[model samples]
Target: MTADRLQPVLAGVMLALVGFASSFAVVLAGLQAVGATSEQAASGLLALLIAQAVGVIWLSRRHRIPLVLAWSTPGAALLVSSGAVEGGWRAAVGAFLVVGALILLTALWPRLGDLIAAIPTPIAQAMLAGVLLSICVEPVRVLLDRPFLVAPILVVWVVLLRVAPKLAVPGAFVATLVVITGYLVDHGAPDLSLAPQVVWTEPTLNWQAVVGLAVPLYVVTMASQNVPGVAVLATFGYRVPWRESMTVTGLGTAAGAMAGGHAVNLAAITAAMAASPESHPDRDRRWIAAYTSGWAYLVLAAVSTALVGVVSAAPHGLVEVVAGLALLGTLGGALKGATESETGREAAVVTFVVAASGVAFGGVGAAFWALLAGLVVHGVLKLGRPSAPRM
Candidate 1:
């Protein structure tokens, strides 16, 4: 292949590598937090990878745009914060299905999509920031608990942050693998099955989980991932097929939910990487990069269970160190988005504190409460303010 063609392939591989390595731990943690067992969590990861791969390849090829999809990172953080709801894991799966239905509903009813978009950016971002804070602190908590064991991963992460920002998290993950190997050498490796695996959970809807988990998950996925994805592509002069994109992601999420996957949505952070001039000078050809990424995800999916087995073998949820490292960047950006606007600062703080407190009532999670509390504060503060006089 010519260099023009080969460059996109490489870019595609790098995108998949960075995307998967940086956030797989978060996905695993999120699934487990909502009561998924190791097998189920691994299946969720597998389902998400396969769904994302199929979505990216199909959309990129059909639209001739570098349309990329990813498992919901912010949504995963929300799940970690939410923990298990009243009905446990099955309820969570049911909520996942509802989120997919909501996405699809929005696609068919533009007004529903508009209502979601109409939610003030500050409010949405503030809630997300609050939900992310707990997960972001995992590295520090892990370090304090076992200083020597976690230090090397952070060191590798810090070293790479200056040298290669994109590879920083992946580098930390590599350090984690080394640490895992050392432990395994000291105590012989556990028996691991290499055979393909899938675990299906029947959806059991519970109102509490729907309110606490589904609502927050759908909002986060849309606000943080799908919306930004559209903007990212637009910046590169590409118009995403909004309906088709939603249809694919919504259906994919629904299908994957039965197998423990939470949600899949449009790519945000990595969308720019694949569509930018860095991928290719010719705009028309950039889709090749995203197309190649789909294949890369399929390959990664094949090894998903094996990685899960190794990480599960590690002591004290050691992947938290790397997962925390991966999320710090996202937390910083979310905080900036939350606090940037002077008008919403008070409401944002209220939301942040409530979410960080991890409070729940009536079996609902803090994420839903945080958003509601912020809105109430935001609205109350606005009640008597002088309106812009006939601007």
Candidate 2:
């Protein structure tokens, strides 16, 4: 292949590596938080990888757009903080199905799609920024907590950002691998089998799980994942078929739920990696990166069990620091987008503060509340404005 063709392939691999290395730990923690055993957690990761691989590859090929897919990191964070439900992980799986069905409904109904689309861009961006603010601060927190291990990683990331902007995150991944490898060698590897297993958890829906998990999962997955995902594609001038993509992700999530996975939606941060100019000079060909990323995800799924084992053994804050480093660019972009417009600035700030506050009301997460608060503030302010003079 010519260098032009080869670059996208490499970019795809880099995107996959960063995606997995950064957040797989969070996925595991989320599963365990919801009362999943190690086997179930591994199965969930595998299921998610498979579903995202199929969705991303199909959508990118069908639409000729770099449409990357990701398991909802924010949804996982919600699971982590929400604690164990009464019906356990099975109930959570049911909640995942509810979210999937909601997304699918949004795709099938034009009015629903229009309503979601009507959300002001600044509010969506602010909500995303708020959702991500906590995760974005981890590198600094890690620096203070484990400077020896995290400091070099940060230094490497900074140096690469200056000298090779495209490779900055990939370089951090490499540094992380080296650190992890040395740690394993020093403290003998954990005794864990690398066998991939598919665990099916029958969905058991309850009113509590529906109100607590289903509603918040749907909200954050839409606000924090899908909305920003579309924004990322638009940033590179790709007019994505938003409804169709949502439909595919929704179906993918439903399929994954049977196998113990959570929501699968369009990617936000990693989508930028695949869709950016650095991935390919010719925007039309960036779909190649998405396709390659799909294949890479499938490969990762094949080794999901082993990957989870490795991450499970790592130091407490190590994976989080890596994730934070990978997300720095994305966080900066969200902050900039959230504050760029004067009209929406106050509402956006309200959204950001509410989301970052991590407050929960009636078992629902702050993300949903943040969007609602911002809209209420926006609407009230608009109403207070004096009517324009008649023509």
- Listed in order, each prediction's TM-score against the native is 0.98, 0.84
Query: lDDT tens string, model 2, 1-391?
Result: 9898799999998888778766776677778777888788899999999999999899999988999999987787667656677688899889889988999998888676567668787887787677667767888998898888888888998998999986777688678767877889998988976878899999999877887678767876887788778888898898879788888999999998878788899897789988888889898999999999999999999899986777677787877676666656656877888899898789999999998887777656576678889999989888988889999
Give residue 144's lDDT in candidate 2 (0 to 100): 93
Residue by residue across 259-288, what tens digits does model 1's lDDT show? 989999999878999999888899999999
Candidate 2 runs further than 4 Å off: 1-15, 18-38, 62-66, 74-88, 206-212, 223-243, 268-288
Best by lDDT: 1
> What is candidate 1's CA lDDT for residue 97?
98
User: Who wins the TM-score comparison?
Assistant: 1
Worst 10 residues of 2 by lDDT: 322-331
lDDT of each: 0.91, 0.82
Give the range of the ten consecutive residues with the poorest summed lDDT in model 1: 316-325
